[model samples]
Target chain A: MPQLERLWNEFKDKGLHIFHVESQGTSEDDLKKFCRAKGMTFPQVMGQGSFSGYEGGSGIPYAFVIGADGKVIWQGREGYHAVITEEMAKVRFPGLGKGSVAKGLEKAAATFAQKNYGKAMADAQKKLEAEKGKSSADAAVVADAEHIIARATAVGERLQKKAENAKAEREYAIAMATYKILEDGFKGQPFGDNAATALDAMKADKEISKEVKALQQLDAMLAQLEKAAADEKKKNLKAFAEKFKGLKAAEKADQMAANL
Target chain B: MRRLGATVLSAAFLFAAPVLMAQADLKGKDAPDFKVGSTINEAQALSLDECRGDVVLIKYWGVN
Candidate 1:
């Protein structure tokens, strides 16, 4: 884990991304604690959707690396370290890199890179207005500021679409998270307002609210499953499935019990 | 996609083959997009294409 953390620190500026996919219902608190203790900074999330074409090997720490071209470049348990090193060297981000940012726009660019789109847009907008019609140096700031605005706007729209798709698919948790980001993160934006309206309408739906409650309760129940002994956890899961009967939550619980 | 431990992996041959098959089947193809079932630290879900044109590593792991 520390090695992975080191890799992240070394290559994050070079555009490397590492994410931990935990399928076994480890509580967010526990996962955060574990990562903190290990000094990990990369995103760690629970698994979803048959891993979208990748296989979950029967191992604790196996990994798969996708190249900048979005192809599976390397995959294995611990052997990935050196391979990642090699793959990292091959990356060449077009028109963007750590050193490409204009000095005047660096701060805003940093915020944008951190995914703080709201703050990034605000800061960049200020720079854009100030630098507009100024000298050649100012033109650099103006260009980067416009780039930030364009990227952030695109991301906002994409998230809005993602939330709608999640809502249609009945994946309420994901829909809510995406909407909350749009609503809170993009506060003054039109997309944010739309997301807020969509979220309110969804929450008002009786069927959606009922299912959301079931999934939340199921998440709460699974938290305890992480600590119990093997046999006890199985028994508890069976009971859980029955408890959630007739709801989609039951199917998820049933899958866990069967896995056990 | 089911359980997250070696015990579950060995217990179910059903999962093992598919994982190996996927490794063989999907190599070099545009990586299939993974979903955020839930986030452990992030505020929102991310689509794989969100990081398009950058190296992304998915480390599939378990607490136990």
Candidate 2:
């Protein structure tokens, strides 16, 4: 392990960027201690959930060898340093090397931060689509990553709206939703001072209550629909009937018939 | 030569595959088996076996 760490430190200066992906359950302190003990100075990452996406899935210390075209050419499980070292040696140096996906992602994140929504969306979509079939051993983690990225993109769309046309109320709502998505969706992300300030501004606004109420209404409606679906599946006519009672008389009749 | 290379590769995987497989299942399932010091100020190794039969709180953070 010391030898591998030394090798990584020696070659990291020459386009060997290491990205550590910590699992949802893993303690960051352990990662920090391990990295510090090994004298590593690489970017450490955390996931939304367990292994959910790539065909094989990914976990801590997994490595990706992305091609010059911003596509992953090689991906390996944890502690497979020699796979990377040997492959990188065989390939040309100072050239278009691996980890284009990470680079592409970093570029997209930068563009998003700069409020370049159009370019950022395009880059994010490309990066996500390109990672379609790759899987690590864990399915849940992969699923969480996919779900988190989707939620992030949706939040980005709302934020993009706020960026383009700054309607006070809409911006406030979008900003609040964005904060929640970032906080809940991607744990341990470096949400800088700007996000903090924007959230504070939104919280102080008077119209926040109205937006909150509206969101509550949406949640209630969704819960109603979910309960209705579940009741119908169980053939619980009384439960289904009770759930549809708040609807208009005609709509109630229609729902009752649908359930029947 | 080719057979020797295959044998070496197979041996390396046999030793490393389970560790890699376990690491890959970090999210969704119960957290991975890890033993870290309980308190930041302390130097005790707390393993999952020690925390068994109890609800354990797991927190992930970046140290500055």
Candidate 3:
């Protein structure tokens, strides 16, 4: 963790964002205390099932380096500082790294890469608006700002179209996934609201609604079964088994419940 | 609660918490985006998708 702090200090000026996520089941206060004691000042957020989905072994101190293209460039359990340093050095923000306007542009570029198109566009516009009538050597900065705005706009449109097409085709899962990207990735934007509406409609669909309920019921039954087995409360086991018998994975659930 | 705590602690220390020496399956794939409450500023939330374009290093850690 200290090594990560070192990396963040060294490369933060160069557009490196280090985010520390407290893994599931860990208390936020404990994580905050740890960070404070370590004198770490980078952004820290709670992680929800991020590592649980990792195909690699689930362990503490896992790190992933995501590039401007929104793809994972490097991921590992250790040596993140070295990998991130090398990656950061390779990024060349033309006409950035100096001046307030350039800094704003740099931030805009970073926001654009993160798929926060609306924020990126708004920031770029603000920078450009501030630079109006000021004849400084900010041509390159202006050009990059314009480019970010255009690219963000184009990407936002593409994502919207993709989601719409998926919904039209009745590919409910794909449509929901795409809308989720727009909703969460571009929150506060019009597109995000649109995605939310689409998601609500998708959830209202009868087939999808039924399937989701079944999954929820299965999860509840499994939880109850686990609790009953742990407490050795055999009386409740029969009721759990009866409930499991009606679920999709009835065979496995029934088998486990029967053992209780 | 005790059992859950034990399971969580075991998982946290599982595999020696080693720096992943092996190549990650997610390398080169689109990083999964997430939004969670921020400790730095409780009123604000942090999202992975908002870090786009910068070199974002996400460290998953446990206090235990």
Best by TM-score: 1
Ranking of all candidate structures by their lDDT, best first? 1, 3, 2
Which scores greater on lDDT, model 1 or model 3?
A: 1
lDDT string, candidate 3, B1-64, tens digits: 9999999998877755563443357888987775555455221114564355557777776677
Please provide, for model 1 over A67-175, each residue's C-alpha lDDT reduced to its tens digit, 9 standing for 90 to 100. Answer: 7677887777778888778877665532122224566777776676666677778988888887774655466677768877877887687788888888887788889
Give one digit per residue, the lDDT tens place, for model 3 in A1-260. 56666776787656677667776666766666566557687877665444333434556677788776667888778876677767775555411221223545878866654566778788888887776658674786777677666656665676788788766664456678889988876678788889999898888888666544554565676566654544454444445446645443344345444444
Fill in the DockQ of model 3: 0.24
| Regions of model 3 farther than 4 Å from truth | A49-56, A92-260, B1-24, B41-45
Scoring each candidate complex against the real one, what DockQ results? 0.29, 0.03, 0.24
lDDT per residue (tens digit) for residues A134-219 in model 2? 56424443333343354345544444344334334443444576665444433343332344555677678666655545445444
Query: Which regions in candidate 2 have their CA more than 4 angstroms from the true location?
Result: A48-63, A78-83, A86-260, B1-64
Quick one: ranking by DockQ, best first? 1, 3, 2
Q: lDDT score of model 2? A: 0.43
What is the Cα-based lDDT of residue A197 in candidate 3?
92
Candidate 1 residue runs with Cα over 4 Å from true position: A1-16, A19-100, A113-115, A129-132, A135-139, A229-235, B1-64
RMSD of 3: 15.8
TM-score of 1: 0.52
Ranking by TM-score: 1, 3, 2
User: Under CAPRI classification, how is model 3 graded?
Assistant: acceptable
